[model samples]
Each structure stands twice: as structure tokens, then as C-alpha cells.
Target: MRLSFFLLFLTCSVFALNIDISNSTIANGKTALLEFKKEKNISYEKIVVDKKTYKIFDNPINSEMSYVLLPISYYEKPSKKKVELFYKEAKKQKTKTLFFKIEDAKYKKEKIKVDGSKVTLSKEDSKRASKEYAEAMQIYKTTNEKSYISQSFILPLNTKITSEFGKARVYNDSLKGYHSGTDFRAKVGTPLIACNDGLVVLATDRFYSGGSVIVDHGQGVYSCYYHMSKLDVQKGTIVKRGELLGLSGDSGRVTGPHLHFSFRVGGEQVDPLQLMKLINKNLLNK
Candidate 1:
């Protein structure tokens, strides 16, 4: 990945600003880390990228800095995108603009065979799935404005990866969609842990995901663990890193038992491994 840093100073301003982006050219379905720093007294309002406004969170490692995670959707077209920073300087709002490039990701195609009923859901199952999707979307759209994570994120399980993120999925000769998450090899009763500190916003069994748990790390960052056989945490539970959240199994629409781990940053589903690396380097470990 390509990294870029920009330092700017407004004329006669009280402080100088430093902006850092994890990559100047990011691949689709990946994530980019954006950092802003100035004097301790200086504060930022929000960030604008690709016509979307995202909230800036206080850097967990450095109190003088703020950061946001930018996720490029897999469906986003390859092009040059702009980032606009909005801040206040001496009672006057100022803006700074930076540009980045998005390239196509070379994701491999995958074909898998599963139960026919899983691929073609019945009418009742389809209705249940739609309701579950809407509920999950509501949780992802709500930003808590406060961060629960103070340290770097960890993987939910330490196992071989069966399927990687962003793979084009062809289920039973029909193109369903791309894999939005990474699948880890697990047995019927393998333990699953929370990736980081978060509040359990949703914990329930659903039509497609089976037993699912969605954690809110706050500031528009969420982690999801899907297809579990058992849920150890409940909604409204505050979990720490490495805490037991559930047990993996073949509970959902899958060919085998595994853990599907994903991330949503700024309301866009991104590659989990990519997001974890960037966040640790640019925010928690900075």
C-alpha cells in the first residue's frame, strides 16, 4: 500500500495542522486510515470524503490528534476521490482538501456448493432475513461518538482462513455476491473471542446469519461475528478484548462450520484484515 502525509498551515493561524493517510492509492473493498493533528487547543468538526460526511474521533493513543477510518466499498468505481477536512480556527471555519486514488482489487472468484434451500430461501425465510437486515443496518448507521477501543484490535480466532474477504462468490452456479468477510476454519464448538472493546448492540439468531453478534466500537466502527452455535454475550453487554463471545459452528448458510468475521467502518463493509492493520498503525499504535 502507498502512504501519504500532508502538513499545512493556515496563514496567521494559531496552530499548524498535520494530516496523514495510510494510503494515497487504496484498493476497492479495503480501508484507509486518516489522521489529523494540531495543537491541543485545536479541534475538528468532521471529515468529508466522496460526498459523505464522517465523524472524527479522538485518537486513543494521542489526545492531541483525531482520526477516522475510510472504507472503500467493493462496488465503488475506480477513480480519484477527494477528502475535505472541516475545522474551526479562531471562530472561523476552515477547510482543507486532499485527494486519493482508488484502484480495482484483484479478488479471486470462489464457487461453493451448499444446501439448495440456503441458496433459494422460502418466502417466510426471505421476509425474516429482510427484517434482520434492516435492524442491523440501523445499528451500523448510529455512531456513538465515543470510542470503546483503547488498544489495537485482535482477530476473533487464530485459525487457518478458509475464505478471504472480497472474493466473488458463485453459489451453486449462480452469482450471489462477493464475500464481505473473512472465514476462519473452526470445528463445531470452537471458541470465539471479541476483537476489541465494544458494546454488544445486537445478539440474536437470524435467518441467514444464524447466531450473530454485532459489536459497536463506536464512532462508526463495528465488528460482526456470524454463524455461531452459541452466543455468550447479550445485547447491552460491554466486552473487552479477547473476551469470549460465542462458539463457532455451522449454524447459518454455510458448507461447513466456520467463523465469518467482518468490519464496518463509516457504514461501508471493508476487508477485516486491512482495516485492523491500518487502525493499529495509524491510530492505536501511533
Candidate 2:
């Protein structure tokens, strides 16, 4: 794990604020943990990064602390970025700016051969896929302020990883797009589990994803499981860590049976493994 810690102290009229960042430099398609602590009462306003505003949520384990997860998309430009933190103390508004470096991940390329129909959807199929995508995006746009899990995130499958995230994918000699999720090798009917405690926001088969499940872990963090053979959970069901989710198989636009796991933090698709490591090491372990 490549980890860097930074601490900054800001003196206010009636309180002192301490800010800690887990990583000083982050790669594209990765996440960083930002923590804030205060000696007295403080109201966190928001966090602005790369001209986008992210919500701040209270730390579940520590009442005096607040934190937010910063996600860098796979296509985000590699350069130095500024993060602005806004807060209120003693009826006065205060702000702080922090800088972090974003570097290219340099993901590998992959070529796959699946059914031609899956790549070129028909009119009906295209409409259905578009509707499904819009529904999923709606769920991701809303952030639950309260976190559901008090422990570190776990892997959905304990098997070998078949494909990594952020890989440029080509289907049938035509460049499609990048792989937005991590793929794990799983046989048909292989039972899968939830990575952490959360509410199942979406559980249904779609035109492109097939049998799919998405969980909201609160505070703008969501985990997605796609291309499942069967879904055991339903929408609005609350699940615990390591609970049964469904069975994995070759579904949707795929060449074989596997589990596709990914994450969205603050509406940005990120590397699931990297987000898990950051959450466990910087938030849960602290």
C-alpha cells in the first residue's frame, strides 16, 4: 500500500481544527480519505475538489470527527488538484485549501470476444438499457448521510481476480470503453456476499448488466455487483457484512462466468480494491 499522511492545524476564535489526509498523491480511478477533527463545536459545510462539491458525513466511530471520500475518475486528468474545505466555527465561516497530485494509473488494454448482439443492441434492447442506466444513476445521485457499516469493508469473493479495473476494453476488434469494475473468477452458481453493511438499492436484471445488485453504504459510497446468475436480495433490504448476495455466473455481455465488483464514491467510478484498502486503513483502523 502506498500511503501518505498529512496533518494541518487551524486556529479559530473558539476552537482548533485539525485536518488529516490519508494520501498526498492519488492515482486515477482511486480514492482518498479526508478526516477532520475539532476541539469544540464545528459545523462542516462542504468539500470542493476539481470544481465539484462533495458532501461531508460524520464519522461513525468518532463523534468529534467528520470525513469524506474523494474519488478520482479513470479519465480524470493527471495533475495537481486543489481541495477546498468549508466549515463554521463560533458563528464565523472558515475555509481551507489542500493540494494533492493525481497521476495516471496506466492501466493495461484487453480484447474480448462476446456475442455480437450484446455489443450492438437492437432498438428495443437499447431503449431498455438506457432506462436501466438512468435508474441506476438516480440512485447514485442521492447520498444517505448516515453510514451503515462500523467495520472495514471486505471482499465479496475470496477467489482469484480475473480482470482489474480501468482496463481499456475492445470487443470484436472495435474499441468499446474501459472496464469500470474488477472481475473475479467464479463458477456458475458460486455464492457471493456483500462487501459491507448497506441497503440494497437496486436488485434486478437489466439488458446490459443482467442480474445485478447495488448497495448503498451511505455518505455517497456505493458498491455494485453485476452479471450475476441469481440475485438473493431485494431492493430496500438491509444487509450485514458478509451476508449472502447472490450467485455468480456468465450473464450479460460476458465471455465466461465471473463476478464483476465495482464502486462509486461521490458519483465517480473508482477501483473497488483501492477504495477498500483506503477505507480499512485510514477510517476503520483509526
Candidate 3:
């Protein structure tokens, strides 16, 4: 008699991953930009962009990179649009780059432009804004949250976007600027809500943000509400979802009453519209 033994082996296929771009084409006076970075050993060329978001029909003639799609804009000058790209591979890389190819409605390389009036900051003001931007980027580079899986992020304030994001802003009659956040047009003293279940990172008043609230929504995803009439939450306070955080008002550099709401996803400034879409798709529809 003889005894025999056999072993069975199985292998699982490993697939490469990337963040694809969606709806990248634009009109002549418009531009499309996608931010991406090189990952170790990962072919950037294998990355396929979201046609709806990226508008790319074929593969790039050159380069292999992993990229993240960003907000697009229409401008008048050839100024570089900037964004932060965070990558991790047993290590980390925090880099900023101008990534995109702009095309007209005719599909030609349109020259991207910028309106210099958007920033009317003095030397001192520029320094301060630069410092704040750096701190926010550091937070994104260190936070570990992986992706936008949360169903609905609570609104910083229960209100409508009166001014809209990225609109050409005119501060006072003399100073001109671009609106960095979506302005929720609300009545004075309207109750504001916390955008997420996170610890209060900053709660204070300043010359520009006026009475502002910044909450660290874990993973470097921070939400800020500004131009507040009142502040109910204090720094270091743990706020629950939909918690009463403040009241709306024309507190900061504004012409009328409104709640200026802003969001930072992994340190990149993204359109709040995406958040609404996520809520509708995952929360309401689900």
C-alpha cells in the first residue's frame, strides 16, 4: 500500500490603482486642471481618467503617473493654477504642481489666464496667508484617512450658497479678490451647524475671517465656517454631527450677511458641490 499527499496553490491577481480625472474639456476662455503625482513602481500611464470628468479619449503620448482630478476654472491671464498632491508608499510625499491641459470648445490648446485683481494683499497680508496655507497642508500630509467614503458631511451652516464658490469677489469698493469659500446666504443670527463629528481645532476672530470656526474632520479633512454672528463652540471642543456651532452674519470682509463655508479634503481646496453630490448619491439615494 502507498500513501500520497497533494497540495493545491492559488494566486490572487493584484491590480494597480489610480485617481481618474472626470470632465476635463472646456471652452476657449476656460481651463481644466488635474493634479497627480508619481508613485513608486506604479505606471502613471496605466491610469485611465474619468471621461466625464477628464475628457481624455486616448492615453497620453508620454508619461506614467497617478493623478487626482481637481477643480477647473476660466481665467484671463497665464497664471499657474496650484494644488496639493499627497502620496504614500510606506512613506509620504507632499507636493504642489500645475497639472492640466486646457483646450477650447474647438479642442485647441487654449492659453490659461488669471485675473491679478483676485489678490489685493499687501506684503504683510501675503505673508500671513502663506503661513496659514502651509499649516493646512501639513495637517493633510499627516492625517491618515484614506478616501471620501463618508455619506453626508454635515453642512457648516444650514443655508444656501448665495455667492457660490470661486466667484470673482469684490471686497469693498476698492479691494478686489476671489471668493475662496461658498457663501451661504443666511439671515443674521441664523443657527449654524457643525459640518462633521470632529474636534474643534480653531475658534477665534481675525481681520479677514472675522469670527471663524475650523474643525478637524479627522484625516486632514477640515471644514471652516466664517463671518459668524456668534460662536457657540470653543477651541478643543468635541462637536457632534449636526451640532449647533455658531450663527450666521456679515462679520468678516463682506458686503452683506452670509455664512462663508469652506472645505479642505486632504489639504486640497475642493468644490463643496462635490460634497453635496456625495450626500445625494450615498445618503439620500441609499
> Where is model 2 more than 4 Å wrong at Cα?
1-16
lDDT of 3 by residue, 105-224 (tens): 321221213233324677886786677666556654555333222345656665566666555544334434455567787888999997657878778775467688887765345678
TM-score of 2: 0.94
User: Using alpha carbons, what is the TM-score of model 3?
Assistant: 0.55
Q: Give per-model TM-scores.
A: 0.94, 0.94, 0.55
Residue-by-residue lDDT tens digits, candidate 1, 1-286: 5444444443454455777777889999998888777655457778898678888888866877888778888998889988788888766788877777989998999999989998998999889889999999888889898889889999999999999999999999999999999999999889999999999999999878889999999889999999999999999999999999999988888888999999998889999998898888667875
What lDDT does each candidate get? 0.87, 0.87, 0.52
Cα displacement (angstroms), candidate 1, residue 255, comes to 0.5
Candidate 1 versus truth, CA RMSD in Å, comes to 2.1
Worst 10 residues of 2 by lDDT: 4-13
Write down the RMSD of all candidates, one decimal each: 2.1, 2.3, 13.1
lDDT by residue for model 2 (1-286), tens: 3343333443334444566778878999999888877446578778898678998888877777778888988888889998888888766888877788999899999999989999999999899989998998889889898899799999998999999999999999998989999999999999999999999999999877778999999989999998899999999999999999999978888898999999999888999998998888878775
Distance from true location, Cα of 138 in model 3, Å: 5.2
